[model samples]
Target: MSGIHLAYDLSFTHTEGRWNQPGAWVGSDFPDVKMFLELARTAERAGVDMLFFGDGSGIPSTWRGSIEPAVEWGIQWPRQDMSPIIAAMSTVTDHIGFGLTYSSTFMHPFYVARLLNSLDHVSGGRIAFNVVASSRGADAANYGYAQLADHDQRYERMEEFIAVCRALWDSVSPDAIERDRATGRFADPAKVHPIDHTGEFFTVKGPLSAVPSPQHHPVVVQAGNSPRGVAASATFADLVFGFGGSLAGQQRHRAMLDAALVDEGRDPAAVGILWATQVIVGRTAAEAITRRDTVLDFWTHEAVGTMLSHNAGYDFSTLPESFRLGELREEIIAANASPAGFIGALVTELGADTVITRDEFFEHGFLAASGLDHTVIGDAATVAETLEQNHADTGARGGFMLSSPLAMPSAYAELSELLVPELRRRGALAPRYPGSTLRENLAV
Candidate 1:
């Protein structure tokens, strides 16, 4: 087995009211701080590599069958902020790396540089940034834009934005800071360089206000999964997330990304490829299947529909279960051209008869129902073997960003207790975090 790292998705804001039934659980039922602390402890104790938070600026109005909007959809609405939460989590855990998603479209590069630098110091150098170009109109409205920019245009702006951020981060060298008590002098002026950058999208002046971080720069994680997204990842990202339903499909995507990195004059080994998998582990295959079925029995159809509606950019709730893939593909293409163009082609290649019922889409991707890929459900040893095989076959450096069934903490416990130990015994998963910094853990 190659280097296998673990990451768990932490969503502080729980979707309780969105369900049709009144008895469904929500954020109020489970406290975010408690959940976060538990997850941090659990992951650290299990020797997990990282804890990643997926965030968004706004909720889609179509999610609740209302243009007016009923529930807070994304991270910003539920959590309000992430930096503070990450700071708290960092203090509570010892070794696990921390990561959060931030958009280049809405934030200033200097501010982002300063904040991320501070996070790196606070986390003891365990920090990563997942760069994204916001696609929602609501997020654009908050930033004073009339509408969201076109997909390609956003990516182009992102390229300049990331460049400016990197320059700002490198402006102040680590040796520049000197706490000289006798002369009361701090930070030598000679070592601090000003980034007087004037780009197409932004103009920034000078060094970041914060001192240089231990990691030099936060690990860059990109997850666009489109042609333009792949190109950007090749140029900028240290790790790129790939989307697919099978090992073969994932390998093809990985090859494409690797080729893109080579074309951009980057070392392919420097960029890790991580595939998303929803995991279900038990003592045996039968036990795992039973657990999965039990969870599916209680799965809320309405909640699933709401999530799909937000992603597909239309209310899938109203569509018939027997809706043709061709019709849905055309509709999605007409609505949001870029995501549909990329996703539609991939979906067709996987197989069009892949019916995307509300239940199936939420369980994993639409094609997961075929059992070809997506969710990895089996006993501890079986799941470990599969992970080892996939890593060996694909040359993917990172491990599964394990998506749980319902609650973040509960799902984490299952993986840590069952799958992780088995992988360790097989010499697949790391026995301990190899280094103090996020980069070291990933590189190991």
Candidate 2:
């Protein structure tokens, strides 16, 4: 890899815990074609490789078994479809790929394949489908499931899901598109083949109706930390979005993913693992700390608790402010298995007897407040140095997915003008986007 690949984890909802934060155009600017177009242009100019939009399928109803807190906090709700925004951005920017979050848990392979295949062609192959195996119960309910499938089984669903999509994408060969105007023939019928796939989770039939795009199939991106998730990524993902936190945690993730890839009969280096992180930059270290503090100040304990309650599938609001992990054993099992495991990990680190008060959990457990478990906060030089060194240490070729909690444009502005240039100078950032297509740029 020439340099670290950076992607903006694009948020469609108003950012920051508070809606009225300065520079927030929550009601007006969201889903605005022009606003996203400008954002895409700015990121592309900054040598950002992709605009990866994170999405959820349903409104969060897990918190207190109510959607009020999620709606009140704007915690990943009021969701807008990313397809239109991606289409608009693709028209204006040539090199910035669009990574769209679509769940394998809910959607059929044929639908996903057709939608992305068309998008890839329209975007000149600057598109990636960020495959997610849906986790939330509310999301499952919307998709006709009484509850989310068992964790390992969900990954099995994902494995079959991607297999069907790949088969559909490959159904029509690249050479199938002949476009012979003289003969009034747009494609070669002989080159098209039916997928006819019937798996345990899904039954997808026939060749895709659409022709193949530049990349054939848009880059497959997966972000699952479970063992089954690693296997799914190893089998299908071109790029893996990793959970960011400790150097050790990420290293372990990469090691397992690499091992999984080898087990799947693929080269370890062929896939990319991108860490999901936040960049808090300032002109000076103190300034960066101040900025980070300001962002933290916006997160209220209740807001964070509500977010966590939705994520873990247990009502934090119902628990006492001071509760021990042992007290919630039954509730923990009732919650999602992955989050229960996360709690177990935290207990192992902090001692299971460790009391997890609502205040602490609120302050540190909410993803945005938690900085997705890892955050880089410093002056431009320090931030660049930390990111470079960590990337070097983690052995992740696909780099950081940058975002800010404050919904401030200035953070990104500083990144473009200060931090990104510093990384480039250190030979850690790509000098320019390598090519017009996402695959080409990522291949660099």
Candidate 3:
């Protein structure tokens, strides 16, 4: 395995939610296929191992029971399905893999299995699935649910969802298909067995309609941070998307995931834990910070409140400005599956006992809104040093998932021009993919 494996976390929107900026290409140009193809080509040229898509199925109405801010700022609305884009991009690149997100909360496993399997075959074993449990009520409503499933219940459903998909994927053995002209036989019936699976959430019968695609099963990726989420990742995920707040925080999460793997009777090193981070690089430190500030300036108090309320799944606008967040722990927990782990983080930043009033929460959110979990801003050398140090300190064999605030073209170009070369020089970035499959390349 290379010292650090890099993947690009891509979104179709303006990078980091800065919309309507003059001369910036975002919403109106998102559907342009030419732009996506070039972006994929750029990432492949940078030797990026995979292009991971982060997806949401619904427009936000959780913020003060309103979708105004999300619609106004283009905060993850007007979303498009990424499957076709993945197919198009895969045709243009040989080795760069694609990770597509699908939620277990709404879709049937059989359909998902077929679609992703075909994509994997078409892409020559270069595709992965980022499994998610849908949390928003809007998404659940669209799927015909009155309210979202309870937090743990959602995870329970997901476990069964993955189980059914796995069985279906393995229903047809590798040697099942054979074109024999002499006997006029196409496939060996004995080799293709029925997966008569009957679980609490899903009951799937027989083998899939299509033959087994390349990679047998596309790489299983998960970003479950809650207890149930961790267990699901440990049991089924090939790659686990993780948080990167600090070296200590990263190390703690890694340890928990490793332990979960042990409980599943799997080797700790078998699963790759990838940390998602945002980077701002410039010719100098000051230049980078200036760019970061420009991004941060977009986070007004109202914007912060809207974004926070949306993420936490609770309306902060309903609470008084002087109310202490500590007292509402239970309510927050009840509100969302992964209640703003950010709330806990904000409290930590302000001191443990500090009351997180509405004003304080908005201020902190506004300050840090532009940055991701582990934001790095610096010149190329400084950024490289920080990444290398974090990798060493946290023992992250899985490496980092990078996002550039600049949209696709600028982001990919900057990475190829500035950051990736630095990593290559330090022997951190892999010179080439080890094999045709994403599983082979991401193996640590």
Predicted structure with the largest TM-score when compared to the true one: 3
Q: Rank the candidates by TM-score, best first.
A: 3, 2, 1
Q: Give me the displacement of residue 378 in model 2, in angstroms.
A: 1.6
What would the per-residue lDDT of candidate 3 be over residues 1-444, giving only the tens digit for each residue? 437888888764463454443335555467677777988898888798999887877777777787888788766566789899899999999999999999999999999998988999989999899888877766776789887778888888888888888888899987889989999999999989889988888888968877888799889999877667888888888888986576666776788899999999998877777887888888799978776766665676666776666666667788776755565555777765345356656654555456666676666666455555568989999999998888877665688888866555665567777998888988886547889798888873
Which pairs of residues collide in candidate 1? none
Q: lDDT of candidate 1?
A: 0.70
Order of models, best lDDT first: 3, 2, 1
Query: Can you write out model 2's per-residue Cα lDDT over 1-444, one digit (the tens) per residue?
Result: 447888888663364452454445545556677767877788878788888888887787876788877777677677787898898888898788999989888888888889999899889889999988777777888878887677778789888888898888889988888889899998888899888887798877779988788889799899887777888889889999987777777888899999999998999887878887887788899977876676666567766766666556666677788877665754665554345334534554566567987767555566544464678888889988888888889874778887765453445666777887788888887547667688888882
What are the RMSDs of all candidates, in order? Answer: 4.2, 2.6, 2.1
In model 3, state the lDDT of residue 430.
56
Count of clashing pairs, candidate 3: 0
Per-model TM-score on C-alpha atoms: 0.85, 0.92, 0.94
Q: State each model's CA lDDT, in order.
A: 0.70, 0.76, 0.78
* Per-residue error (Å), model 2, residue 147: 1.3
Q: In candidate 2, list every pair of residues with a backbone clash.
A: none
Per-residue alpha-carbon lDDT of model 1 for 1-444, expressed as tens digits?
Answer: 466877775543243221222222355343456667767888788888888777766665445555333253221235446778789889999889988888887888888888899999999999999888776655666689865676777788888888998998899988999999999999799989989999889999877887899898999888876778888888899887666466666776788788998999988877777777777787789977875665443324444455445554566666665545666666664554335422454465646666665444445533332222577889888888888888888884666776655344555677888888888877777548878799888882
